[model samples]
Target chain A: MRVTPAVELDDVSFGYRPGQRVLEGVTLRLGEGEFVAVAGPNGGGKTTLVRLILGLERPGDGRALLFGEPAHRFSQRRTLGYLAQRFELGGDAPATVREVVSAGRLAAGGLIGPMRRRDRELVAEAIERVGLSERADAPLRTLSGGQQQRAFIAKALAGEPSLLVLDEPTTGVDAETQESLAALLDRLHSELGVTIVYVSHEFGAVERFVQRLVLVRRTIVFDGSPQELPGIWHDPSHVHA
Target chain B: MLESEFMRLALGAGIVIGVLAPAVGFFLVQRRQSLIGDGIGHVAFAGVAAGILLDVSPVLTALVAAVLGGVVIEVLRSRGGTAGDQALALVFYTGIALGVVLISTAGALNVDLFQYLFGSILTVTRTDLVVIAALGAVGLATVGLLYRALAAVVVDEEGARVAGVPIGGLNIAVAALAAVTVALSMRVVGILLVAALMVLPVSAAGRMAWSMRSTFVLAMAIGLGSSLVGLTISYYADLPPGGTIVLAAAVVFGTAVVVSAARGR
Candidate 1:
């Protein structure tokens, strides 16, 4: 008898409106600790898949499962930390970096009456883990775009999620900051044993850090390692590097 | 002096609206749906005009119309897609225009419609005050019961939906509550300034407050402070209390903006 994977989608299909099918017969599975990088073209349903996995969108047909149960049935939403591509932390929102980071704890039902000492420490640890210790007290609007993104990530990290799902985390971040974020993500998977499912267009940039590559072009074209993806996705005759 | 019965009723209504307006307005501001409240106010005015024409209580008509308008807006937003904004704008303008035509052509009542438009404290009957109190209590309780869900929805609708927050239901609930507040506030601040009452206090509070709970509490305090001061000023200066209240709120907003800028925000 084999154990079911952490996440599984069985012949899932979806459309934004009445009859336009954006994704069809899309089946996918991720084990408990797998760091799967979802790669695809610009209009491919990579982000849509992430949304379905996060239980943000209901599949038009078929079943979606998390931990062997229906994805919608899983009430422990705190177990997954998600960073959307366009998360808005409003300019006039009066929250420090630490306060914003603490917001992640909200999913865990961690806001019990008030901010506890342990919650504060968790916030501190999450901030430090993101290398944002010095800027914890700084207001969110004052930080650079990269720092702001990191703060949002730290907020997600504060919940101690078993799975981290990020959509283009390094989209607007500088190269140096992108490398640091990649390293941090790698450390999270390797050392902390966290499952990571990230969607990105830049496959070459994240190829080294990912364990499994799910090449998505509206549907699952290939599900294999980064090395195995080149032959399936690339032209064999024109292979370089 | 508060010796006069009408003055007492007006003062009481002012204070209650002070609290109710800002509390509901905070949610509107957060969701960027402040304009929705304005549309509700206009629809409520049509209800008021109908009440005057039919020789029934305007409050009842306003309440019914406001709620219906809110639900209509929600439906339009969800179903109409590209035409949502235009539909809402049409609802607002049509309501106001219909209200004007109805009130002016209403040869039966001989009641001055402009009194309701700008809010006349002298006209606030005890029955009106009682209605205000009851509706205010319901509005506040609804907000309290659903604070967590409301906070989640306002912060991130997509995230909250994924977390099983019931986005559509919550949105409808918010619209319903906004309608109620607008209708209740119409009798005190007038339909034209209902959005001002809702937005100004909360906007001022947002400048200094970090948490939702604190922001709400501060907005209430600011509202109460302004209403009391405004009422007193109006009584002494022989001016319109609603205008005074709005002016006071504007001053608070201006001060907050200045201080925030000075602090290099």
Candidate 2:
């Protein structure tokens, strides 16, 4: 029996302004439990595509579906976990690692009322999964960039989402930290069997990890296995095109 | 001091503002919108002037004006572009200008800016105290009911939005609460402490709190302590309550600053 696709974009088009398409004629389907890397140059609309899939934007035409429902109207907020671009997760938020991570449960647990016992346990488990259990109570500002990123990932994990979408998770981290992060994500994907969509300009960090790679520059330029990554994507200079 | 009816009213108002300011101000300080309470206070001055001219209670008119000003600021800031803060500055200047014009028009009557700029114990009636208490309770309820979602939005708007946190509603709720605190505190501690009470205690608490809930609770404790001490000392020394209260909070803030610096932060 075939399961419903985790995400589907059928001839979807979008633009911040009319006649200025940021993404156009995009047709894609991500299977359940698949790990995919979406890469592109700056302003290449990779982020826009993920945003569309995450229900942050609406398509100008055609349908963008999440689990066979229209993406924009997908109301199971708890089922989707998102880690935004790096700079967007600033360090001066005045919250602890556990505090930020526990917020992942907000979409699962209602905004008001105390956190259920299971919610607390989930938060702790998420922190442990990211290897930051020792610094769980520390302020986010005290951590290095990679650790902070891990804290945010733990935040996403605490929700126990069925699908995890990470945008620029490796931005500003060193290569070593990036490798560790990729390893952590790979571990999470295999263990949890969640649909993972990783968006980044530097897809090489997760290149060996994602099952399929899709390149975007206002549209889908490539979609295939990592071993088949086109030569043009290997050149940083051609990325600007 | 304890025997006087006026003292009793002042202390009651103090207790309420102690609970009100930091409850809402925690989010304001976290979001770097520390100046918003002050902005609401300025617009509230215009409301006070208009109230005096129309023979209505200044607190009610100020509440209306401040909430409008707060919503306006939130809307402008929510647009999220280069023009946001500049637009807020524009509103701030215009509000005071409008108040000055209104006060001048009321010059023929016995309108004292000093009374509102710096609170008067004599002007605070039992009825005024009741008004402050009721509205303050409502503001606290708003914060308590929406604490988690509010924190999510404050820490990460886009992330919260993606999580289905109602960003617009929560932002407006915060703005509305700030307005309520400004209007109520203006009646008790004056506009000076109205804004200071929101920002200072939260700043001081930030130095020590490792978690969001701790910062929120500790800030409330500081606000409450400052309110009680400042009002009591001002009554005994015949000093300006607003200035004294703000000084009390500033002292806590200064100590916190030293603590932060000493720790190599």
Candidate 3:
């Protein structure tokens, strides 16, 4: 039997206000182990699409499914890793790199219970995988932007998620850091076989890493291999026929 | 220190409230909801006034009202009917107005509202002590059990939701805990000064601690220390106990700020 697609949006529609549709009739599917980049101009519903897939927001119409289950009913959240657009250490509560990564284990058993031995091992392994083992005990604020981003990725990796969703993961970092993030993600995809879906408005740095590109403009205007994108987007406001 | 029965009861209740208030307040500060305590304090006042109107135990009534107010605040927040601060301000002013109206309509001017407003540690009876102990125990237990969920929500609410942390339930749980803490604390510091106890010590702890766990321990220690020292000073100097205690906490916070700044933090 064929494995289910990691994410599926069928004729999905969503709006923040009663009549202002952000995304309308958006239908797309991503098979397991696929590396897909969703690129769009600002206010083009890229974040909204990610929110719908993460079940943070429901589609106003049609359906959103994850791993063949309806998004709202899919409770095995441990299998899905999500890095929000604005991840930051809150207020004065200083968290170390290891502590930040350990939060990924929250899905296994919420913040109240004891973590199994396996959870510890996974946290340690994720820290190492993200190349932050040396800074595991360092406070997150002490790390560079790149290192902090890696720590967050390690946090996502600690859950051992098969489907990883990142929203604007490279919004603030330097080009070098973005390149390193892209490399780390490419490795996770090719080696660990973690399916990746990332949303970004800036595509120059990330385009080489993704196998497929989904250009979202209120709706998915383009979905094809990365090579096919340049020929079609002479102007972003209007797509080529 | 434990010479008189009233002194003993006062000290006992002080210790309990000291530990419990800052423990809950740490998360409040983390989530930038420190003002929720102030809002809940006003609502608890309304509860107390209504209780007086009905000839009921004011503490019990305050507990119920504060909890309901907390839940309402969370519900309003989740519904996005208004901004968080706007919603809280609405509740805060309405609660205080309702309290004033209830007190006047019942002609409870002779009911010693000042005692509840500014606290009367010497007036704490055996029944008051029991109520404080029970509420303190429940409040602390809830915080302990929900430590991780609370931390996750405070750190990143949207991330916590995606991880299936039940954001709505945790929000209300924290709010209710704040309400209970406010009600129990009213016995020590009074409704007017309760938010100080909840916030100052935690702010001091946050200045020094490097992690969430350490912040909790340090905040509890500071809270307990302030209460004990304040109570002793009040006993010797014949000062108002609640004001002394709150002033002590403020001193600790100010000292922490200066010391941290001196250390080039």
Candidate 4:
């Protein structure tokens, strides 16, 4: 039997202050095993939408569901991996590369119970997947920015999440790291069948990698394959900038 | 050379504070609000002065005020209306000013404010030890139970929240813990140096270790070792216990810095 949509946001509305609707009657859905991107300008409710999905904020109206259950009641957070846009790692945090990645397994209860042999293997796999196995013993502060980002991804992947939601993971990364991350995303979605929902300011190989494109300019502008994007501008003043 | 009951009490108090200070200091450093502990310590001084004025145990007064001060600081931080540095300054000045005023008006002209300012393990009592011991046990248990969640929040608060960690509650709880440490260590390290005990040991450990758990262990070891050694040195050299302990911590901290630098970051 086919699984339901990974996430469904129905008429969700929210804002910081009263009488100011940041996201007014927004609705969207994500299917299982689908690679989707939610693209929009700054202050266009993109991050807010992600936050709603991550259960960080409650909608002012309507309902949200994840994996066919009420979002709040969905306790399978261990199966969900997220990389927020405003990522901050404790700078003076003493965590080494291996330990930092191991944090990803915290949701999986890796620290509470004894780690099985398989868990150790998975931890090593996560480190290797991030291409930082050599630096596994090093502290997080010692890594370069790109390596740190990769380590964070390793942390997210450590739980073997069914769905990976990343909000602008390539913000401060170098070109090579960005490409590598993109390639990794392709591998995760296509090869591993993990659902992917991400938001980005720019589109690279994402157009080729993503199965669906959700162009959200404060509303559901479009939700379809990337190749079907219209060449002609819908708005007269629409420019790349 | 070891015939003084006063010295024994002082040594015991110093050892207890040594463990308690670093225990709470680890989380403060983790949150990167090491200075907030200093601010709490100053507020605790006001509490101490209040106790002295009313003929009450200074430790009791300090505990009440330190907890209240910690809550106020936490409220300000969560409100996000004021800059952290500004709030810290406000709390620091108010605490010190109030302490000075109360001490002056109380007419205890013989009371040396220097002892409160510089600390004296010699002044610790059996009651003080009991209070410190109880607070220390509570702090340790809280930290142990909340270690994972605290670690998650300290590293990435929003991320931790998204990942189902209770960020706000844990933050307040940690603030309370720091306040307890501040109140307890006031007699041993003084208001000015209590924050040093928290920051120096953690920072030194962070330079060498690569995990929060390991860092905590290393900091505790360093703190305990330094405090004991400092106490012995002070006893033999006829120096102040607080100064000696702080100096020992400084020596360890200096060593860590040199080693990290030499090892090339």
DockQ of each: 0.27, 0.52, 0.56, 0.42
Where model 2 places Cα greater than 4 Å from the true spot, the runs are A1-3, A87-93, A235-241, B108-111
Give candidate 4 misplaced runs (Cα > 4 Å): A1-4, A17-25, A60-63, A68-79, A110-125, A128-134, A160-162, A190-192, A231-241, B1-3, B81-92, B109-112
**For residues B136-232, what per-residue lDDT tens digits would candidate 1 score against the true structure?**
8988888877665566555555554444445688778888998998888776778888888888988999887765567778988898888888888
lDDT string for model 2 (A1-241, tens) is 8779999999999999988999989999999999999988989998899899988899998899998889889977678889988534332446888888887888887788678899999999999999999999988888999899988888888888888999988888787888788889999999999899999898767787889999899999999997887665663522222
- lDDT tens readout by residue for model 1, A1-241: 9787888999999889999888889999999998888878878888888878877778999888877777877776767788877876632445578767766766565322456678779989989988899998876767888788888888778778877888888787676667667777888788778888888765555667889989887789889988876555742322131
Model 4: TM-score, first chain: 0.89
Write candidate 4's Cα lDDT for A34-101 as tens digits.
88977767778888888788776788897888898777767887788888796657647567777777
Model 2: how far residue B38 lies from native, Å: 1.7
lDDT per residue, candidate 4, B1-265, as tens digits? 4488777777777777777677778878877788889889889989988988999977788899999999888877776655865786798889989988888788754547767777878777787777777778887777777676567666666555556655677778888988988887877877778888877888888888767778888888888888888888988998987888889999999999999999987
Note the B-chain TM-score for every model. Answer: 0.95, 0.95, 0.96, 0.93
| A-chain TM-score, model 3 | 0.93
Clashing residue pairs, candidate 4? Answer: A94-B210, A95-B210, A96-B210
What is the interface RMSD, in angstroms, for predicted model 1? Answer: 3.8
Worst 10 residues of 1 chain B by lDDT: B156-165
Model 3 residue B234 CA deviation in Å: 1.2
Note the Cα lDDT for every prediction shown.
0.79, 0.85, 0.86, 0.78
Better of 3 and 4 by lDDT: 3
lDDT of 3 by residue, B1-265 (tens): 6879999999999999899999998888888878889889899989989999999998889999999998998777677745865887799999999999998887886648988898888889999899889879988888988886677666666666787767788889999999999889888999999889989999998788777678788999999999999999999999999999999999999999999899876
Which is the leading candidate under lDDT? 3
Candidate 4 lDDT score at position A3: 66
**Considering summed lDDT, which 10 consecutive residues are worst modelled in model 3 chain A?**
A232-241
Predicted model with the maximum TM-score: 3
Worst 10 residues of 2 chain A by lDDT: A232-241
